[model samples]
Target: MSKFKNLVVNLSLTLGGLFMGVIIGEIGLRVASIEGYQKIGDFVDSAPTSFHTAHPDLGWKLKPGASGEWKGEGASFVRVNSNGLRDDREHTKAKPPNTLRVAVLGDSFTEAIHVPVEQTFWSKLERKLGNCAAVKGRKNVEVLNLGVQGYGTGQQLMMLRKKVWDYNPDIVVLAFFTGNDVINNSPKLEYDLYRPFFVYNASGKLVPDMSFRKLAPLDRNQRAVSFVDRLPSWLVNNSRILQVAKKADLDLKKRQISKDFTVLRANNFNPPKDAVWDNAWRVTEDLIVTMRNEVVQKNADFLLVVVGDPIQVNRDPQRRNKFMQENKIQDLFYPDKRLEKLGNREGFRVLTLAEQFKGYTEKFQVCVHGFDNSVPCGGHWNEIGHRLASIKISQNLCQQLKQSQLPKR
Candidate 1:
């Protein structure tokens, strides 16, 4: 009887200890989260709206006929056409005659739902193009924003293959975000697990698949949440410990990324003569080549527009250097140079937004991609940034066309 009683007592004590430890740990996490945790676990409830609808082939898309006031960091009135783009007007699959149609394909930067519709870079460019064409006595010009947030080049290529040609564009502008797009091209990158990924073949060929080489891997990691991520918002918002751990986890992942993939060296900004870098380059280049050929087949002029990362072009030299140090980068625009070189070799025109943004930033003393203080850098181009991008693209396109007409002078 005494033994039984002692056993019961021991079990009770163990349960009590565990219960207390959990409570204490939770409190510790809450106390340590100085700025509070935001991107914990899956962040399922974080999206401000249901603007994106998933597609089997396209991966995801802006909902067709979705009209609402969607809010991210900033509020914007979003209206998706019947064809599922954030355009005020509907576009037909068969473009009207004398209409110079342009299609812009990219990720969130291209979609840019954070700002008002009129302020989006593509919108500004469309208006500018129209006005310019009118001045030149040319036909009507229409620029279509076919960008979807979080789209990788694979998706962009898919868009080109399956959708963009439906509009029968005269020009196709591909907005390539150099930062994440590189990793997104490789199935080995963790980001590839969430979205569709591409891989190279035994013959050193590029193939797009969301699989582990031959088989599709389980996306268990994407939907899985850590113990801390499962906590209530109030606790997470207050827990500095959890926030620190999460940041450490992110830092650790970045470190692992360097090990897993052949990343650009910060010291030289060159992709090392390694297998990972080679695979990534081949995969991405193949996609670009495929896209260019497809656009050409459709009788459209293809332009690879390289978007500069904010860290590479921040107005503050110190902050920019720190960002480079964190990423171990030296040239800052290494990816830009690498892509530009590839485009040049392949006879494709690559227009970089880095020079434009950097030049404008030098004069204004204000950032085009980010705001001041705790607001956090947007990383997406702002109104001023978008306007400049439009001008540069328009000017370059016009110049190239004129040069082509120069009769080999």
Candidate 2:
């Protein structure tokens, strides 16, 4: 009898302890969430309107869209549907009865931050191109800015394959930024599984999938945890942590990182000779081949526009030279001079803008992600910079168009 009583008492105590622990853990998590909310509030209070909109949980004033005007804490513009392309009211769509649909693909440079939709390179290019009699009266050319900020080549490819492909675009202009595209292609601690969320599966259906390569060994729970961690806002706002981890991951990158990491580094940047440039090249080559094949299968012309950063054309040749000299890092821009050689070898249209806009760097004290005057420092081009880039790109496109029309030899 006493033994049975003791056993019951022990079981009760154990159960009670577990119950208490669970309750405490729940309270702790709630406290953490509240504290997190406070931190987010503080962050929003100090951040810019753009920053707040990007992170609404951080105490940003929200002005919901009313009567087609979408006003918010930082943005003064309203969102309106202009000829199927959602743009600001200031930037009207091309007078239709004329419709030339062009899709612009890339990262932030293509997205055109810190500038109004009218000022975006796409809008400006549309205005410039639509005015031409050759393009005018013949259905106004509509440039769809499909550029999402912080997307890498892989993401861009995925986006194009899934989202932009259905548009049946007349022209697809890929603005390739050389600076961080390589890095973005690589994997890190906090992977953005959400960015390239929708991928066209074998069935030709867009399905939600994580961007990273799958690990066959991961258990269901582990996969679930990874999925939760990759939530859009969670991964994006916490990107700083990933950046830090990436910088520190140089050593363990080989064994722990995905093959795409090595591939992107080798083909996109200058890797050390002993480093796996060959492997990287093979991977990128495969990706390019697959992308090209897809383009061909779709009967769409694939044009590769090689865009470089200010560092590529800075007056101080030694700016990049130092990194090369110290780390023996080769210039990824000229990876085997493939981008250039491929243009000549494969007839791929390549537009190198490093030298074209080199002079404009002087107008701003900082180059490649810094504020000129009081603007924030990041890779995104300022309004004027974006305009200049757009003009240069438009001129290139015009030349390409003219060349395409010429009788084939």
**Which of the numbered candidates is closest to the native, going by highest lDDT?**
1
Which residue ranges in model 2 land beyond 4 Å of their true spot?
A: 1-86, 89-98, 188-281, 313-326, 329-332, 359-369, 372-378
TM-score of each: 0.78, 0.58
lDDT agreement with native, every candidate: 0.72, 0.52
Query: Scored by Cα lDDT, where does model 1 land?
Result: 0.72
* Candidate 1: tens digits of C-alpha lDDT, residues 1-409: 9999999999999999987887787777656643534445332322224887756565568888988786555557888899988888888889887887889999888888767888888887777776653324666778899998877798789888788888888889999987677666765554434456666679866666644323222232432334455567676666566666666665666677655443432322446446776676677888998899888888789999988877666777788777567766657778788889988888889998886687777777777785332244445776777778888888766765556556764
lDDT of 2: 0.52
Clashing pairs in 1: 29-239, 30-239, 32-240, 32-241, 33-239, 33-240, 33-241, 34-240, 266-328, 266-329
lDDT of 2 by residue, 88-166 (tens): 4322333244466777887667754445677677889888877654566665677777665566566567767666766
Q: Model 1 off-target regions past 4 Å?
A: 12-49, 133-135, 202-204, 210-224, 227-274, 325-327, 371-378, 404-409
